[model samples]
Target: MSSRYQQGLGQDASSLSGPVRQRSKQACLPCRRRKRKCDGNLPCNICKGYGYDCEFDNGAQSANLKRPVPSDGSPQPGGKVTRLTYPQEHPKQPTESPFFPGILEPSKARYVGRYSSIAFPLYVGLEVQATKIPRLHSFAYHTGIRKEPPCAVTCEAAQKIPWNTARSLIEVYTATVHPVFGFLDMDQLYVRCEKHWHGQPQDLVFEAMMSGVIAMASLFSGTLDQDTEMWFILHAKEILEDCVISRFPSLEQIAAWTLRTIYMRCTARPHVTWLSSCTVMHLVEAAGLHHASEFVMQTTGNAAPSPEMFNIVNRVARVATSLHILIAFEYGRSIITLNGQILENLHPTTGAKDLTFQLCSLVAAVPTNLSGDALPMMQELFSSLDMITSVTVDHDFLLLLRADLALGIYRRLRVMDSKFQQGHNDRVIAAGTAALPAARRLASQNRPWWNVIGTVFQFACALLVMDTPTSCERLVETMDTLEMIVDHLNTHLAKEALSTARQLVRASLDKKRRGVESLEHIVRDASPDSTVSDTNDHLPQDTAAMSPSLTSQLPLDLDSLWAMEFQLPL
Candidate 1:
């Protein structure tokens, strides 16, 4: 061997002369384990590289120092070798030998359960402490924290204990306390397996159990608390970020479900107060309907939703729609009346147009009966009208027309009796009439047929409310407006306006059922499906046959007169 190789071998030549020498010359044990090269050092360069507190076995050290010397000055069985060595000191006391009298064989040590007695008291104390802490008490209500109060207590206790004690407690708790809470507290159950026994082959078993528990809870409850909702959202988002988004795309399902449950609960009632409109909108966009549908399909299992479930879901959807409409209307109203900065930042025409279209769509979707909740909803609609009419007419003139017509019908029928209480009819009618002309003027410019029809209807309603025939002249002017609508009703706009006209006509006929024969004749002639005949051409033939004295003395039926005055068609 070269002097360099000889120098590489330690002076304890016998110990260096076997497989140990080969390994040391090639790579030190630490370096070999790390799969790296070793530089000659007391602690090999690899051990230093890895920052281990390197140690040497005393038997190995002694053997290296006792190698035999060769008689002929040639290399002998136990070769003379020089080795790199670290500076050291000799001990003042002799080291006790590991050998024993009986030469006891090495075997696996048996655990004698040293701390078993303390386990019961320790568990009891943990339970007491967990129940006492307010924060932990709140955590118990959390969906995944731990179902069983005691398990959560144990978990809290385990966190504070010494490692060996904690390990013992955890093992005992997992075997005993875990079964009770495993179904209740997912976080505690998961933490038990994840934190206590991590890195062992049993991690997959715990993970599968946790996944099962979570899946079951989601299936049954169909919801979670606010904090749990947030936790799942964040946790699932992280998992997707680390493993799913780019690589394992299928795992995106987890993130998708987390978001869907959060949204569903956020929008559902009782908890509806827990989330705002803006939050729900953002979550819905994030969850994406397709993903939510998939999650529902997968999780909703064999127990089909009961009638109550459907009702609850429908109610939630309706409420959400109402809230959205209310929000949009509030914005539109602010723009019109307050001249709010929100409007200044927006294009008035564009903003109004968008809001009007949305409001109309919402109105169309809102159920007409709405389970007798229509009054509050109508009040909200009318409030919007009051605001919009104060602004530029172009913003919501059509909506105002429709709203006024509906309000008029509502007041006359006493559908919302509370609104007209204490003789408030005159004020209501006056405010409504004052708001109509501007709306009518704007509607006439853009939608003439509707404006004329709506104007005539309002005029008739006004005349019916008037105390004297002096107001009959206003009826003459309303007749002129009706003529324009009649002209279009004979043309193409009939189909579009027919339903509204028919409803108005029906109300009028129902009111005037016992009035003058001429009124009854006019009602019989009005048909939404057929064009109106010229009443002027037929009037001479009809009126000549009636007795003037009888007509003069005829007391009009209040309902029939009201009905005839507003007659259009059903």
Candidate 2:
């Protein structure tokens, strides 16, 4: 080789001046900025590697770049480069639909963005698709919370209350809660349970009866700490769990669950209440209480049960059935998959001037999920609303509440039915935007707790999922308003709800402002042996991080079941 160079009259190796630098035209623009090795292929390896809209320039000229890429072509010890090549720069063709830049294959991109198309099902982003709930750190349990059945607790606290102490609590309950629940009989409770109250503290029915009274009294008192409510519920639940584990089925067990459901409702745990309500229904059916009339006839036919005992079980069954129907409606679940027979036998126990009876009538009149003629359903709901023209101090506390709930449910049905309609969307936004403040106002004016807060919150969530600027703005406003009133809520359940609402709002805002880079959208690819750098952690200081917790928190895996239950704050 030396002899050939000498023969060709080339300059000596010493005179080459250290390989002579290119007087400075170097890597392409993207490679220069990313400090990556450029293959100099018009869309350089680095640009192509990151799905970036790559362009190029020398000292004299540059051209248009469109990208679909992996990482740069720079050599790592075991670097796995996905090399996507494209035509050399076409000066006339402009790129379209540029999304946020990312690393890896499109599916595994670190900072993935929404897929855009003129006519196809859009993937909002592979990242966003990963966290279906958009983890806003809200108190609302993600669908994956393993809800174990109720556990056995001694409820040493509940059993210790003296028999004499229950009278006032019972009075408070009869005065405040019974009017709404209507699932218990005061005369029978006072007459038949007095002996158990003074003597048998371990009696399940006695514990349930006192728990209801104490819990209701605590709630209606209006100033008790939220834990006090849970304490009452925990105590009551322990009592019932004892009966349930024993597989005991009785009219007393039915009454206990009715109280438990009421407590759950009062505490904003409607899903829990639904669970309790189903138990009540199960017991009702088991005891043949649902066939109250037949049971009465048969028992009378045998002369084995007194008419009074027969009437008690019959009324308890009737009220429990009514309550079940209402919960089913509120939860969008069909009760017993209601049919001609069940609907025929269905009636609200006819002994109370309370909200349950009113709701029972409405439930019997309007089918769950309202799939029939909209005109008739709307008219019936309106008729129910008309029955309560004004809410006065004398009015039952739950009257205006469940009425508002019916209206909210009606609106929800509208949102579901006309989802694609612009009018429906607009009305929903308007109603949800206006509704939360009204709820807060009502809570302030009357009671701190509203049975329908969950409905309103769910509606607000619906608005947010719409993903429009209007929806987002309304959600922010709703969260801000809820924030102001959250502290006033006396129960931890409702307080936790407002706190979670704020978290979700914050998460939504981060998602909106940061595009699709939030960590909730992070997807782990199939590469078991590959290690990817934290994409956002390496982000330049100029751009804000989408999720600060990206490095620490992993997006949780969940089922879609929790999403449905999220309709309530449970």
The number of the candidate with the highest TM-score is 2
Stretches > 4 Å off in candidate 1: 1-399, 402-413, 416-424, 427-474, 488-570
The lDDT per prediction is 0.33, 0.49
- Model 2 TM-score relative to the real fold: 0.46
**TM-score, predicted candidate 1 vs. hidden true structure:** 0.23
Residues 438-523 of candidate 1 have per-residue lDDT tens digits of: 44454344333223355445555555545235434444554445554555446444344444444554666566665677787887
Root-mean-square deviation of candidate 2: 37.5
Q: Provide the TM-score for each candidate, comma-separated.
A: 0.23, 0.46
Backbone Cα, N, C clashes tallied per candidate: 18, 4
Q: What is the lDDT of candidate 2?
A: 0.49
Off by over 4 Å in 2: 1-159, 191-203, 222-235, 243-248, 268-271, 292-300, 303-314, 337-352, 369-442, 445-452, 458-484, 490-570
Candidate maximizing lDDT: 2
lDDT of 2 at 50: 46
